[model samples]
Target chain A: MSQAACIVGIGETDFCRKPGSGMSQLALQLRAATAAIQDAGLTPRVIDGIMPFPNLGRAEQFAANLGCENLRFAATIHTGGAAPVASLQAAATAVNAGMATHVLLPAGWNGYSGARVRQTVSQDVASIPGGAIARDYYLPFGFTAPPQWYSVMARRHMYEFGTTPEQLGTIAVTMRKHAQLNPKAVMHGRSMTLDDYLASPMLADPYRFFDCCLETDGAAAVVVTSAERARDLAAKPIQIMSGACGQPYPADEITNRKDFFRTGLSIAAPEAFGKAGIGPSDVDFAMIYDCFTFELLQQLEEAGFCKRGEGGHFVEGGRIELGGELPVNTHGGLLSEAHVLGMSHITEAVRQLRGEAEGRQVEGAEIGVVTGWGDFGDGSIAILRR
Target chain B: MSEYTKPLPELEGHTKDFYGFCKQGELHFQRCSACGTWRHVPRELCAECGSWDWEWARSSGRGEVYTWTVVGRALHPAFQQSCPYAPTVIELEEGVRLLSEVLDVAPEALEIGMPVEVVFEAVTDEITLPKFKRVAAS
Candidate 1:
């Protein structure tokens, strides 16, 4: 069997409320892509493969603008936030198949500065056009925005497992603390108390103002290559031991899923761990996606960090904090850091495994996991090791 | 009462039958003729057997609340006056769930497994939405 591919380089733009540059979306992508190429100690000419998260930006446009001399392979995966890990899986597959040597994956969004800002409040936010899932079923009943759809599961988790708002508050509080150590975080230096969380106005019931991820304008990129090539790169190679994306039955339509509290990660976790030849117990730390604090709670259970429905209590007393066991989102995930569609989580995992995560580093961390949740709990997991 | 301001379902393809039945004030779902499995959101293939064969079965409109959330924020201008409406999932006796607006009840009063019955409201001259009302305990 071929050896696992490695993340040779990772780069991110200044994460902020608005990217002050007048650059188009493609320009932001090229900046991150060029930075990643330079970080890998390779010129853009060596990049022969391009894999982008579906529909964020055009792969051909990136290859052309970034000056990739040999764009031998290009593909994209669409699962919303799940696209990050899915792109990693595609890179591994392409590299292992000898389809390309160096692969670039770039993600960028101007969510705050672009017209997309209005999308967050629109009932038609993020739904597939001409699709029954949103147009026919959800939008008709005001199940429109991402927060609204996720709140159904949050309420169900509360009803089924008696998960308290305070437990979920721990996740938000912990992420903010992590963000304090990350200068690039949008919410950096903005401290939050559990009481602050409780007092924040309700955006959707069960989700206070702090419960939602920030609308950010930023970009991040990653470079994947053969493990052998990674050894020759500037940064320590973070091996992609395993990457997988999946969903449980009735995946897209949240209301129809068999178990509302359970995410697709329930199915994806074992698949990733099994492929990595490791289990959840082997993970030293992790970067579970936190688009919403409750998502982190549910993902903790789905990723086998705790028993089903016990995630609320698992987060209590700072278990996921920086100094605690299984320190997650060490760079303050999408919740506190920036929502680059979970690509930031992947870069944080690379940083933690490489021992480059300056202040928020998990002590002596060797093995770690990154997870993505999107589109009504469709999940993706990637297990990485130094 | 003023007509509901939220967007109404656009009838097309598989959803035509669903709204057609709702226009007549009857809740309908597809039960696979081959596998006898019930499905929602009105699709063609059987969820269990992969059979394209199915029939429109009328729902008794009697079910219990499986789970729900009160959308405190209005996602659209139409819902501005209707903030704090509870959009719920009602698990009908047929064992398939449907998303509907819950009416005649305060969000605080809604609970899991609470009994509910369907009520059709004409939002427009052409569209009649099927919502749910709390069924008082006997």
Candidate 2:
């Protein structure tokens, strides 16, 4: 049998709100990819597989730019923000099946410097997920942004579960607090109290400005190989225990879902935890996707860390803070960290497993979980162990 | 009419019929002939079954507020003038949800399970949107 897949190298470009000259999307991706290849103690020519983020670029283009020749396996995960974590499954499967020796996964975009979702007027329906639905049903009603689309679910959650704005504020405050320890975080040293969170301008009802993630122009990359080959690599290997991706019913549209509270994580978390022979309690730390404050809280409940509707209380009393029960988003998160489409969450997971997280490191952390929340409730989860 | 600066639905393919129905001052959804499952934002096949047999059935134009959000900032350029509007999801009596604006209702007065009924507005000669209003207690 082939050895289990392991992550040997991880690299990321500087997370920033704005990019200087020459920081195109592809440029950011190439910078991160080169760093990861070198960190793995290998050259570009040795990499035999590639997985690129959907709609950003193609695998062949990335392979050619990185000087990676003789590529065997190539695939792109189209699960939106969930693409990065979902790509791990494809990379691991390729390596263990002898289809490839080394697989490189890269995800990034010029969210700030280029086409921003909030600012850009999308004319091509083919480019966006559920474009027809959005154009026909949503945009006509002035619901044109992510915060507007997701706020309905958050509002329903508040109505059914009695979730509060303060509960959601706790997540924003905690993530900003965690960002304070990492200098790479875009919001590092920008202190925010719970009062500050409440004082932030409301973008969408039930979602204050602080509830949203940063629109960053950056990239992050990871190198995966079999466990046997990882023994010879320069960096310590963090085993890819298991990972999976899932979509909620009628994945593209959220308004018609039979159960409003159920999300893609509600389906994926069980399968991922089952495959790993572990549960939420076994996780030493987690990198739950923090695209929004309510989203992070919802993922926590859906991922089985807490029961449904209990997320509002689960985050209170500093339980998710650095020293608390389960330190979440130790390298900040999409909320305070740059939003490289959740790829930074995976890099942070690797850093935690390698005991290189510096001041924000969870001491003696041997196992961790990373999750991704994408367009319209799509979710992916990966469990890693040192 | 102030040029109706907001976005208008792209009436094409499966979506053309939906907008056509609205333009006629009526609301309808595709209901599967095989399983009787009503669906919206029109598609070809039934979600519950694999049947392609469906029809655009007229609705009673009544529903309850399932969920809502009050937009304090308009993300789109055309909607900048309409700041602080409420976009709502109305669960129609036919068991389908439609996203539309709730007219003449204060944002604070919107509540889950509040009864509402559909109303029409002709934004342009080509499109008539189906908006909603709170049903007075009777």
Candidate 3:
């Protein structure tokens, strides 16, 4: 078996903000998996491995529904939003180890319809990420949601580095602008300006409404196989050059971290870029996990796109816009695009590499990076090449 | 006071003593005897030294505001009444940080590195939360 792996195919269901799709989570997962398999020019029986997102569904059920005859490898990633990007590493490892020829990674959730973060906090303490710390420490003070939890870091960043709300607004405006080009984006038709972003109601301190990612109901899947096998595949294979996952100390809790500003991407990014034998400058674009605007800025710094405390300036002056130095979130990202748990980031990267992104395509894009931020600060990065 | 409608801490085996100390009007954190490191959200073993031998060391109940967020909109149904409350992260003098709210301070008044002292709020008969208040400058 060859050591190299490539993403052979990608697929996703329509991104929605409500449960009106009339499809169960499992049905959505299978639909995406089927589309991905078909896009690879392979039947369901040929898919030998599965990497299912935790809590979405089980591998066995996915295999049974997809009609896989011989399911060789099966595993689930538990790093929250980071799971999708990290699954590329797992799939690459499995394929390179001769354990599986083709691995299907599927991620989807009823984020808006089924269990919103507000509702999930009250459901079961065990189900929530950092459940113990959240129930005991955060909830009692009414710090229940992602916006509240992440706002602490955002405020600290501003205090330490003088990151203004306008810098954050630029990100929200840029993403919404990109969304206008992407019909699949949840906020495609809705344009936003920096003034509008500043005018948006504040959800938490240092974080306005536009700073938050859409609570999307969606699913996306990708097929990974050895680069050697990819030659015989139908789709233009996007090489999975390097993938890495990292967790900050005390990954579950946020308040106790030694350097509250440092995130898991700080550790994962260098390792991934090094493994790929490249630096941040070599990439043509980036599909950064934009769970929040501040997070996107933080990841850019941590991912080595710019120096620490310089992310605000790095994103300024249309540097991250389309046709800029490094186009980011060409599919509008989680902020304007539907939040598919960062799986959409992966698919968008593939589309860009394959030159399939119609209006948002970066001209002659060869290298692209995608990142995922999950739980408190767990991060994953995958460097892809054409 | 009216009934405490918000979510309360689930007293696990490891966390019960920490809450118990709060109920007694004291703030305590698990300190590793070997490494002399303090930890919060009480855990069984030391994260730094991996030692199970630890003690519930009393805190001076004084800390500084490490960071905070004024939730403009309540994510929880109960907090809707208390819209725009600041949930603060306080770094204690002992060098451990915990999540709590700074009482009697406006959201704009809260500053990073502002001195604060712990205050126990008995929300329910069984649960006592350790919150914070600004320390007046001498």
Q: What is the TM-score of chain A alone in each candidate?
A: 0.96, 0.97, 0.97
lDDT for residue A350 in candidate 1, whole number 0-100: 89
Predicted chain A of candidate 3: TM-score: 0.97
Better of 2 and 3 by lDDT: 3
Model 1, span A227-339: residue lDDT tens: 88887788888899999888757776777766666667888898999988898888899899898989998888988999988999899988899888779898888888988
CAPRI docking class of candidate 1: medium
- Per-residue lDDT over A183-244 for candidate 2, one digit per residue giving the tens place of the 0 to 100 score: 99999999899999999998999899999999888899999999999999999999999988
| Cα-based lDDT for every prediction | 0.83, 0.88, 0.90
What range of 10 consecutive residues in model 1 chain A has the weakest lDDT sum? A121-130
Best model number under lDDT? 3
Q: How high is the lDDT of residue A134 in model 1?
A: 77
User: Candidate 3's residue-wise lDDT over A1-386, tens digit each?
Assistant: 13469999999999988544468889988888899999999899989999998778999999898889899999988888889999998899899899999999998877788778766754567766787777877787898988888989999999899899999999999999999999999898999888899999989988999999998888999999998999999999999999999998788789998887677888999999999999999999999999999999999999999998999998999999998998999899999998899999999999999999999889999999999999888899999999
* Model 3 agreement with the true structure over B47-138: per-residue lDDT tens digits: 89899999999999999999999899898898998988899999999999988988878988998889999998888999998988888853
Per-residue lDDT of model 2, residues B66-111, tens digit only: 9988889888887888889988999999999999988978987888
- For candidate 2, list the clashing residue pairs, or say none: none
Candidate 3 residue A130 Cα shift, in angstroms, is 1.4
- Higher-TM-score candidate of 1 and 2: 2
lDDT of 1 by residue, B37-90 (tens): 888867769877899999999889999898777877776667777888888889
Candidate 3 fnat reads: 0.87
**Model 2 chain A poorest 10 in a row by lDDT:** A120-129
Q: Specify the CAPRI tier of model 3.
A: high
TM-score of chain B of 1: 0.92
